[model samples]
Target: MASVGFRGDLSQAFRARIPILYVESYEEHRALAEIAAVARDPELVRTPRALLTWSPTSGLIQPDGTARRGAIDPEDALVAALRTEEPSVFVFCDLHGTLGPAVVRLLRDVAVAFRAGPVPRTLIILAPALHIPHDLEKEVSILDFPLPAETEIRALLDRMIDDNVATGRITVTLTPGDRERFAKAALGLTLHEAENAFARAMVDDAVLAPADLAVVHEEKRQAVRKSGLLEFVEPHTGLADVGGLENLKRWLLRRDGTWLDEAAAWGLPAPRGVLITGVPGCGKSLTAKAVAAGWGLPLLRLDMGRVFSGLVGSSEQNMRTAIRAAEATSPCVLWVDEIEKGLAASGSGSGSGDNTGTGARVFGTFLTWLQEKTRPVFVMATANDIARLPAELLRKGRFDEIFFVDLPTGPERTAIWTVHLNRRLSRPAVAGRLDLTPALLTELTKLTDGFSGAEIEQAVVSALYDAFAQRRPLEREDLVRAVTNTVPLSVTQAERITAIRSWAADRAVAATAPEDWDMGTGNGRAVEF
Candidate 1:
């Protein structure tokens, strides 16, 4: 009950004699401390209750190290709690790992006894995960184990610093702001994890500074490791690496750092997120990565394909686990690439045979999270086909905005060519050797009017390959031949492109300016390449 900051509910449970309470947490010692505090509270409970705890190894042991005669098995542990007459809180640690039919029966017995007895005796189950046999599901209440709050984490850091200062061994030179930064970075971590992160940071520099926030983030990675659902991406590319889409870039930049305290003081809620849909290779995925780097936050790519499971109820559980992982790492960017394909399974409601309605359920679970999530997890969902996406998903309040990324325009192509060419020529082997000037980029951009940001990049690579194969310096002619030989998506999928253009005309905000959007099309419109 305490780990998730639910200590206040403990009293009501005690008063109502709720049969059993379960708290899922990784920090056994910290959870024990919270329960101990709850046992002493007079406001929540009418009378102060004694605290006793049991584990498989520890059996039935009092807080003061006194061992009550009991069996080592879990069934006996519950009997021990029931037989004890004193008004007390009995915590069963790691008992879920050994839950059986017999254990469930014993727990049911303890609940019946607690509900009927005058002396309030509560059985609190503490485990890293939740497991309730169906018989006791109604009788048992599960409480979320919340991560360490900012104030709690900062106190832990201060205590660590004071200990080091008293020892006169490690340096203690953190400003109040520095301490707060470390604590904020350590958010979503358990108290034990926070202490270890602080200790590791101190050992690295002998003093705690704002620079040591990386150590705290490293600790947060452990949570990601445990959750195979969300992949933690190390963002190295920034918006500078992305070309064109100035309107989209500006929208994102204006909201940078909006999740901080200052933004809250301004009475603005964090921007929800954006849905980027249109051309497949028009920098949709690239912008997702750039935003995380530009905003200075961790990037998490959620693999939607991995969320579904064959086992009944497991698929829903996986979705919940993924959401928890994302929320736990708040102030982070969540990239769901090709989101349309991931959710396309929702429409398969056949009157015939569609199995268990699993697809619809999984999609519903994701939609609910997207609509109701209050965390700072900014979801960046990219899509290529608008029709594949559920119609309800495009409605108001799902995403802050839906952006349509078309094929690069003439000027945008010029910018894309410039970025790619400059990047290639600046390499150690070619820097200052290739005369890649604005004139050459302008010539290349004019020739590739229908190309995308990705196709433009490929054009650069093709030009380099042609030049390298000849064992000579690159000339503008090499790029000209490359563009002439390439067929852009706009040419191969003209009808589809026209359909997308018409669909997004009124429904989505064009990722490019009007002048730019009108400059490119391989259909009835002219294309030099």
Candidate 2:
């Protein structure tokens, strides 16, 4: 669940006299400070309570650094909390690992005593990981503690800049816009982590400039890599690298800044996501990568295969973990490549041999999150087999639009040839005096009439290899021979291509522009406006 403000949620729970509150977070100090703030404010919690903290080593300690005598043990700590006369907020730090039977029983006793007492008292358990025993599951309420928001991170950055500038330790060259960009880049990091990133950026060159944003992004990359479920993708190619699909490109470009406040003022909610389904070897995956680069957003690749595990009940947990990680890294793109393979079973009526129904349950969890998620996590999913996709996924509102990528048309093919040729032959060493003339490009495009984008790229690579073997400059003959020797996917899988085209005719908007679509071949419709 999305976190309401931490202080507000904690205060309400305390006011309601919640006996046990479990907060799972890596920010122990921040969590404690928030709790202390709420506990001390009568206006917030409706009752001013003394704050007390306990740890295995520290035992029971008050806010003034005084420890209760003989309360070093877990049981003793709980007993002392129960025996306390004044209304108090008792916080247990890193107690997840020590939840033995004795500790569990004592916790339950404390919960019971705190709830029944006339005075308002609350017990909070703070840990990096949650490990509530089955017996105490009903009694414990999990409260979400999210990473620092953009405003908080921005404040931290401003404070650090002021301090460094006052001491002449570092130069400040960032504009207001650059500061905002830095804060947004550090959105997924905790306050401590953000501080570290800011510090590193400042010290790297004794000055904080716009280029320091890369250092902050590198820090974020490390954090995301630690989460096993999501792979942080470094986009090396932007929309410019993509050869065609002008319609899809235009649609994506229009929604680029919709997540910003300016768009919200215009009554434009952030675009939910888009589904790209097309024949294999087309540019569906490439588009997903290019969009992230073009938008200057971090790209996270979610491997659905990794979400399903052999252990019972772990699949659901994995899905939740993946979703949480994605949400935590907000204002980013989530690329789910080949989504059909992961959700195929969920679409089948008989569960598609998944007797445990784990696939369906996971799918349900994902669908619910996709529909109701408030975070700006743009889901970019691609599918090679539309038939395998669940009908529920294709329904309106799951995605902003569905796009179909077909084999390159004559114009698109020419553009594709030009892109590949220029990318390789532009280098003097690789060019070897070979001129990339317009006539040669047109000839290559005609020779690759039915080739997919991948096929066209391979043909370029093959021609270069042939020239390399001959120890001579790349010649027209080399290119011609490579194109003539290649057999494209549309030739071998003609029936499959026809089936997918027919499916996309009425359902999906063509990726290519209406003018660029090959209407004479009756392949793709001109529905994209």
Candidate 3:
């Protein structure tokens, strides 16, 4: 379904006698252009209205774009709007910050007058955020001026390219797919912001290659930065960086291109998401990050703490904003780390409990969206306590699969050790001296008997520190000492780990291979290293 464009939406709202429209936006010029478009189109408005703009800096402006005499104050502008004989649309720009009783009264008065009057005049209040007064809440209309669509962003990019190429200052080598990709990259940016980003890329070494797409991602991160609830993470590691979990990795790889046009043509719905729950440090969160990187999508972390606002009703709004942002940047991954922690409060979300189930309502909103969202926004949620997650979250159709991440088995541990040691030892200064043979990896793996992947990595780090203190290269003895000195979580929380494993054996799919599931078959209790 096509979304309501500015011209269509504004026209519909205006024609429907929506007295006062409060638009939250940063693109003032684009909004003005939309208003002008609405005014000029005979079919858009029943009786074409004259477009007039009002800003505190410039006061009230006439239909011809000329300033009115001494109409600087917003009060004067509202009075003039009420008195005007011609049907007009008074576009009030950025007046929300200064909205007070006096301004609100004038607005209410104008709204009543416009509703009664035969002329078609509208008082639109423009601001970056929504802050409606209780008095005017029922009367005033609120709308969001959405970011420019990909088509608009693409047009802006093409114009920028044409402008630069005409001067012979920048080189342009964009294929049709390249242009589509670039337009898609600038998806969430405003028209002006997209232009600025494109200009920055074109001027950078005077080239606009596929390599320059990173510049767009870098610039678009500003949106996530402003949203205190969602954080943009750079996922440098791919599936290859993950030591094991071949089952999980293979599942993800199969869904990697399923969201593409070809897969859609094959009548495949985009892969919804997966829940990775298990041991605390068994690469649950790492898999979330790696999936986004491997799929060539941006990763946005939803900070649940921020989503639960102290202000009533704001939590719902915040959730909606986050959802809008994620959809706007479609075909992206939305990662919620330790998701169970956020939704557990959702039991409180139903509104019947204390706090009126505000938290529960928020989770309800998220859950409903997860089940129904049409956008290709794959949710990669990680949780340690699957038991704490809402029962509905694990039901069929909520997620593609629920995979349980367990402690590394013998070979998985060996692979994990090899990955860590090689990554550290393959460095320029240590590559020559370090021996990353299969025998050494097997010995190191046995040393980490009950260790999680994180424990193994930490052991490697401790070994490096020991060698650093000795002012010598890392030796097998240092690693062995580190392993002996450290204790793994499996022993300390053995009962809890066993309980989690038992719970997952039937409920969740194993992230490990069939062979990896057979732990302690060939492995001994002693630290072999």
Candidate 4:
């Protein structure tokens, strides 16, 4: 149901006399306009058909305000369509809401009659959500009517700007680049929504500037939140906030602007995404947040737990809904935290556990989207246990790359320690008399050698607690004592850590740079790019 060449597809269906076509879209006006265009185009449809639209309130009506008398109800509207002899495209709007047994039977009858009748006709059901009856499943073909494309959004913006500026209602101070960014930010919005967003931005101060991009993004946030399937993540951290994983950071930095049109001109595809998996308490989830913040793109978190429903087939629909939302919010990041837990059952046969193949179906829907998605939705999925993940997920092309985030290496530990210490010690109250010198950092780094980033952070917190209890300045001994008392995951889960490392040794790229790989700890690999 992608919108690429959708008009052409609709035309083909019309010419082929595909009796019934269902379009799911929130922008009823836009969908109808497209349908009208195709129906009236003789070159496209080969035989131009008259366009008649129907809603429960308006019933069947032509473009000239000519409504069929006594056809105010859906049943009557269908009856009118069946009686009309002209080749026409009858669009029933929001008919899904009032579907009854009688209405379903009437629709089925219409489908059969339209295909075999003398004149070619098609019934188009347009609704905000799909609600085709089980009996009409084979008869109805659902067409995806996508949100406004970048070009359409840009045009809407330009018209709004021109009108406002011509009337001296607003001051426009956007450069070509800024205009492009505005359009890209509004990509997922409908033309009407984009117009409203642009109007709000222009009217806010009677002056439109680059700062108005926030207003546009805020509108998108509201739209995404309404979907219920995806959470619009407000980024609080960037890649710089992350302690280490120099290789991963570098890879991310290199692809920062690859989602832009300039990169496409250079024949570079937007990065599909990266799978970060390794020791628990490492920076896998943190990296997902940071990537979105660093890229300055909206981050949508897909909670696979919420994707499954108690209903029979709702889970697959939920997955599709989530994907559509993510795609609509593109050039954005789709973060799936703790992905292994959600899709673990999918590793085995078609159906697993008690869900009766629901999990597998949902997983299949997600995997298929991940592989075939054309939008610039960078999927950042994290996992603590890669062993639970399906092998199909680990294969090439599912993700741009699979990064193994091992326990902090010596240099990585040093970086982690530095990040935590600086963040806390920057406060005059916390620093007291402690000096964050190179020697101090080196000492702490060596003490927390096998520790994950989270453990190191907790050590700092624990040291702070100790210092707070004593009501004295933070001393180096406080940190040393904390490290001495704490046991890292590398010690308790040594076997599991070893298994993860062994799996990554050949299959995954070490998140740490080769130079930073610690042979002593057996944490990272010396893999070359």
What TM-score, over all chains together, does every model reach? 0.88, 0.92, 0.90, 0.87
lDDT of 3 by residue, 1-529 (tens): 0124667888898888787998888888877777788877898888888888888899998877799997889888888888987788888888887788898899889889988888788888877778888999888887767787767777778888888899999998898777877887778777777788788899899988878887888776787777676888999999877867777898999997676666878999999999988888989999999998898778999988778777789988889889988887766899999998878757545532346778878888998999999888899999887668778888888899998887777766877787788888876654445677878878887888779889998999998988788677788888889999887898988888887888888888878667545454432112111
Candidate 4 displacement at residue 489 in angstroms: 1.3
Steric overlap count per candidate: 3, 0, 7, 0
Residue-level lDDT of model 4, residues 215-322, one tens digit each, is 888889999999999998888999987766778998999999798888899999989999988889988988999998887788889998889888889988999989
**TM-score of predicted structure 3:** 0.90
TM-score of 2: 0.92
lDDT scores of the candidates, listed in order: 0.79, 0.86, 0.81, 0.86
Using lDDT as the measure, name the better of candidate 3 and candidate 4: 4
Candidate 1 lDDT tens digits, 1-529: 2244467666667777786899888888877887787789897678889998889997888768787775577887787788888888999999988888899888888888998997888899999888887898888988766777778887888899999888875886677756666766677788888889899998996876666777777777787878999888877789866766767887899998687776789998888899998877988998999998787677889998788776788877888989899888886889999988777756564201246777777778888888998888899999898877778788788899998887766767777777788788777654434677777767887888788878888888888898788766666777788899999998999888888888888888877555434344311112111
For model 4, the stretches where C-alpha displacement exceeds 4 angstroms are: 1-4, 168-175, 204-211, 350-352, 409-414, 425-443, 464-481, 516-529
Which scores greater on TM-score, model 3 or model 4? 3
Candidate 3 weakest lDDT stretch, 10 residues? 520-529
Question: What clash pairs does model 2 have?
Answer: none
The CA lDDT at 191 in model 4 is: 82
TM-score order of candidates, best first? 2, 3, 1, 4
